[model samples]
Target chain A: MTKMTMVEALNLAMRQEMEKDDRVIILGEDVGVDGGVFRVTDSLISTFGEQRVVDTPLAESGIIGTSIGMAVYGLRPVCEIQFSGFSYYIFHQLEAHAARLRHRSQGRFHVPLVVRTPCGGGVRALEHHSESREAYYAHTPGVKMVIPSGPRNARALLVSAIRDPDPVVFFEPKALYRAFREEVPEEEESMPLGQPQLVREGDDVTIISYGAMMVPVLEAADSLKEKDGIVAEIIDLLTISPLDDTLIASSVQKTGRAVVVHEAPRSFGPGAELVARLVEKSFYYLEAPVKRVTGYDIVYPLFAREKAYMPDTGKIVQAVKETLEV
Target chain B: MPRSEIELPYRIEYLSILDENGNLDKELEPDIPDDILVKLHREMLSGRRFDERMLNLQRQGRIGTFPPIKGQEASQLGAVATLKNSDWMVPAFREALAEFWRGKPRENFILFYGGYDEGGAVEEGRNDLPVAIPVGSQMLHAVGIGMGIQYRRKDDVVMTFFGDGATSEGDFHEALNFAGVFQAPVIFICQNNQWAISVPRSRQTHAKTLAQKALAHGLPGIQVDGNDVLAVYAAAREAVERARTGKGPTLIECFTYRMSLHTTADDPKKYRSEDEVKEWEKRDPIPRFQAYLTQKGLLTDEVVEQLEADIAQEIQGAIDRAEKLMAREVDPLDMFNHTFAELPPSLILQRQEAELDLSLRKEEDRHD
Candidate 1:
């Protein structure tokens, strides 16, 4: 086991996968000599050389369009959009071509590509850098969405994303890139996508969350247990698209109360889907209405008000407490 | 050599190896064999007949709305002739002639506009992407395939065909920029057919010519007489060789004209004058090539008669086979299966629901 941050673990995952599969290629802006804007792909160029690790021009649409072609042509390409907010430029390729290639071709073609981008805000970034646009990708059919909370899951999920037969958008939480280090099994451990992880089990209230919000949710769960003597179960949703709906529904059924946390806007975020799934599957089991601790529906502010906009431990604990009382 | 002074005057030259009356510029003509010329002429005639048959089919309410490729055969066949079987082709909607010349089955092309998924069911070992309906998007896909070739260290070039209107899309610029920067082994063939539906070419751009647009993107752009197969073939061959030999991408603008409606749904007569159509009809690619073949003693009335008979019989047989197989149309259930490599439980349930709906409808029909 090697103790590494999320960035290091992800880089190691890509290196291992590329070493194992010659067909695996990396293409994006500054992923070569520049090592990506966050250095997540740092030192990868020297190890893999220029052929495998490519630095493309500043054209997101072209990056995705070409990646789709490469994937259809039988190469496993992991394309980076630099930032999740910038992924809008590539949505046409993703939604129209990449997602529908197999369907349109009647299984004659499949694009086994992984689109990676840094998402969510906690490090106080400027405009278009810290937005959570997972809903836009997950809402589209044929493509899978995988988001990781910390170092270990990031490594494992990215490995699975590359291995997946369909195109996957792997959203990395920039906030947690270096927030903490954990003993991530470098090459030994791999996690299955589309399944939720039981972070901490409890009975009173089940809290479902993903991406950067998992950090604050876990804190609130611990604080709720220690201060209020309220046991709150935390479920980290690793994959957002093919959601582990059964797990969330069953946990909500048992606990009879729930709180969904996310940094995405509350209106149509993954929280809305989780809440609807709970109500749809185990409506009578719920003891109270589902509570949501999420970011405001306004544009994510700069550093000064970043914490205020994002869901924090204080807000998550209060939401959980209210749900528990009901 | 990459660096050059801009002091000298530059002009975008047009190449025409064969004139309107089938007279070849002896110095510029390629040394094409008689058998190859016969084959080229036969394919162009077949393409013309196919276009005519599709137009009739649409009028009879048999096939779906279709774009007529009356005068663009040589423009397509000449550029696509240089591609090997191992190379990748990303074609747009109006590129049936190119695909057919590249050895894609006429049946596949028919099934596609016939509104079926199997139309795009390019079999194993074929690297041709399906005819993209959206304008200009496939250009980027071509660049991507080029990058893949670069990665594999293969000397294969990827080619994508688009119309003049597609150059106005953002994808076109991005694709050109990426291809130029990465030195991707891609050939961009812009079939400048004069009209983008109702929009005239002049209204589309302020530039004097479409070929000059590639210069801004740092690619060698050439203009060829699209009506002259020999001229198009020469320019395309040179561009394909440049890409395959690692000289990077080239943009070849095939200057041609659309002699039919944009599609079965369009009425060209409403937007353009009959005089314009009459002018282009005189420059049709088929007669121009036939004239050249007749001059070289390569094509005679006997060969023409036999070739026309063979093409008509072959097309009639393919149509009969396609029409008879109408019952084997792609099932709607195919939507759920290929969406993902493995259907998640939710999708499986959705498929079951769809199946259930089908059964219930069948049951109701039984009562009737």
Candidate 2:
């Protein structure tokens, strides 16, 4: 076991997977000599040679579309879309081809491809770099969507994504890349794609969130306990599309009050889907209507306004207070 | 050494031999055995008859929708003739002729047209992909499969069929670009059938010809007279041979015309004049090929009658088989299935809800 940040864990997973399989290749902008702008692919090009670790021309569609071709041809391609916002250009290929190829071919072909992008708003990044639009992918059928909240899950889920016989969109929270360290197993240990993790146990209220929002949710839980004597249960929804609703419902039933959080706009956000599911399954157990703390439904603002745009500990605590009052 | 910066343009060619009178011009005859020529003519005739049956079925509401390939029979059959059973085929919507040659049962096509699975005719590892409907999506798959075959060091080649309208899509450009750079053993066969729904060939492109577009990708592009069966076969054969020998990819543009509406739902008369139809009718490939066979003393009236009778019986049998098969109850959860190897919890819950709804319906029926 080793203590590492989410970014470091991801880099280690890539290195480990590459060492195990020669068919694996990584391609993206700034992924090679620059070690990726986020350094998620640092030292990979040097260790694995340029052919396997390619720094491609700055074309998102080309990167993704060509990776599909490569994946079809037998290479397990791991493509990096510089940021989540830049991934929109390749959605046509992702939806029309990558997602449909296996079923269209009636299981004759499998695209064991993983597309990784840094998602969520925090750290005051530039425009288009801080948006969490993973809900769009979670809504798309045929592709698996996984968002790991910390280093340990990041390393495990990425390896699973690479080895899975389907296309997976692995969203790494940019804010949590270096947020904390945890002991990731040296041996290959993978978490299944569609399971949620119960991050903390409490009996009063359940706080369901994933990715960057996990930070504030935990912080809010700490504040609630220290100040208001409220024990807040936290559930990290690891996979958004193949949502671990079973775990969510169980957690909601235990707590009786649920608050869903994310760094995407409020309307039609992933949190909306979670809230709807909670209402459908645990409506009788709830003490209050489900609440959501999410980004505003507007264009991701400039850096200065990002703090206001994202959910924070104060907002989460307030939602908890309201739930307790109800 | 620094690479030189220079701009170069490539030219594409469209080839044909059948004259407007449906007579083969003597100069462009292929030197193949008489048996092969007869087989080619039979395939083209079968395609024409099958297409005519489908159009009628659609009109009678027996089939949901269909994209007819009436005037384009010669181009589709000729191009497919150059391929072996082991070679791969990627098709756009209007390649029913190619699908027939690929041994797709007529019933499967009817099932697909009757609002069954989108891939009713798709048989995996059988050298053909399902009909791609999003215009130009399959071209990339063709390139990718070709790359895979090359990586495995297989001798097989992949042929992708598209139309002139597909040239405008980004996937088409990206497929061609990747095929060029990777030197993949793939052939891009574009059947320029002169209309994408109501859009004319002129509206789709302005490069004087569609074949010339291949030059930009560093591949040879040839244009064949789509009405001339011999010309299409020869061009496709040459391209396939080049690919098999590791010479890289080729783009063949078969300039053809859609003699019928885009599909049964479309009304060509709304946009096109009858005069244009009459012009193409004069160059109908079936009669032209029949005339060639007769001039060569390879086809007789008795043989033609027997061929028609045999094909009509086969097509009717397929239709009967498709209609007789019990229709499975359409499961709502089937939409969730095949999305992934395992159902996600959210979809599993959605499926359970649907099951609950079905049980409620059953109880209501019992009470009624």
Candidate 3:
């Protein structure tokens, strides 16, 4: 095991996958000689040559459209969008071709494609660089949307996304790219695509979150335990789509109260889906209404107002307490 | 101060081996086997017959709306004739004839227009991509497949087909740019049918020739008489050879006309004139090719009769088969299939809910 950040863990996953499978290829703008904008694919060009680590021309639709073609042609292509905001240019290709290719062809062809882009706020970056828009991909049918909170899960889930048969949109939390480090195993390890991991088991209320918000969620759980004498169950929802709901439903059933947290806007966000699922699966078991601490419906604010836009520890703690009140 | 004109590397060329009067430029004619020429003529004829039959079927409500491949048969079948079985054919919606020439069954097209998911199921080992309905989207896939072929050091090239209006799309430029940058062995065939639904080709782009659009991306570009089978075949053959030998990508714009509506649902009378349609009818590919083949002693009146009869029987057989397939009770649950390799738990629950809903509906229907 070695201590690595999320960026290093993701790079290691791509390296290991490429080494094991000759069909695996990495391509995007500046992904080759210049590594990547965020340096997530650093030093990969030297190891895999330009053929496998291709530096494509700067066009989002072209990168993804060509990647879909490569995947359909029996090559495992992992493409990168410079940022999550740039992903809008690729949504047409994603929705029309990548997401629908398998179902459109009735299993005649499938896209073994992985699209990795850094998302979420708190990096104090330029406009369009921040924002968590997992809802767009999660709402798309025949596409898998996965977000990893930390280094360990990021590495394992990225490997799983690479091996998945369908197209997978992997949103790497830009905030967590180097925020912390974890001891990631050097050997091959992969978590299932849709299974949520229970980081903490408690009885008072279930605190469910994913991606970069898990940092504040963890801090709030600790604060709730020490200050309020309330132990909160923590669930990290790695895969937003295909939400196994098994863990969330059972966790909510046990806790009888739940608080969901995310960095995306509150309206029609992943938090809404979690709350709806809880109401459906564990309605009778509920002690109080499920609360959500999420970003506002307005545009993701600039760095000056980033704090007020994101769901921090204080907001999560307050939401959890609100769920526990009744 | 006077500025000197910059000398460009490429000069776009126009090719026309056969004229509207069935006259061929003997020196420019490609040396093709007599049997293959006959096959090409037969396939073009079959494509025309298929279009006529499909139109009648749609009028009778036998199939859903589909784009008609009239007047563009030579552009499609002739270009596709240059492809070997090992090469790939990435197609947009209007390349049904090309797909048929590449070994896709006629019934598949019928099934697709009939709105069945099984229609898009390409058999294993065929390198053909399913017909992409979105305009210009399949071109990038062709470039990607070429990239894969280059990586494997294979000689097989990829040929993709799209319409003239697709040139306006960003994907069109992006696909051409990447193909040129990567030196991917891909032949882009733009069938300039002169119309994108209600919009005319002139409105699609300001460029004088769609073929010249490739020059901006550093690729060879050429224009051809799309109605002339000899011209399209020759250009496709040259492009295929160039790509096969790793000379990089080329763009061939076959200037054709939309003799029919853009689709079954479109009304050409609303936007186009009858005089223009008549002008293009004089240059229709089939009769021109037929007259040329007959003059060369390669075709006879008896052969024409025999070929038409064969095409009729084949299309009738396909229609009957599609009708039989359509008669079967469609499984509602089949919609949930093929979204993923394995159904996730969420999908499993949704499928179960659908199944239970169907069973409960059946019970209610029995009581009613």
Best by lDDT: 3
Q: Give model 1's clash tally.
A: 0
Per-residue lDDT tens digits for candidate 3, residues A228-276, read 9999999999999989899989998998999989989777999999999
Residue B273's lDDT in candidate 1: 89
Clash list (residue pairs), candidate 1 = none
Reference-based TM-score of each model: 0.56, 0.56, 0.58
lDDT tens digits, residues A77-137, model 1?
9988778887887899999999999999999999999999999987644446678989999
Q: What's chain A's TM-score in each predicted model?
A: 0.98, 0.97, 0.99
Name the runs in model 3 displaced over 4 angstroms.
A1-326
What would the per-residue lDDT of candidate 1 be over residues B67-184, giving only the tens digit for each residue? 7898899998888888888998999888888887777778766665565445667777778887775557789999999999999999999989999877766788889999999999
Question: Which is better, 2 or 3, measured by TM-score?
Answer: 3
TM-score of chain B of each: 0.95, 0.91, 0.98
Which lDDT tens digits does candidate 3 get at residues B101-190?
A: 888888878777776657778888889998876566779999999999999999999999999867866889999999999999999999
TM-score, candidate 3, chain B alone: 0.98
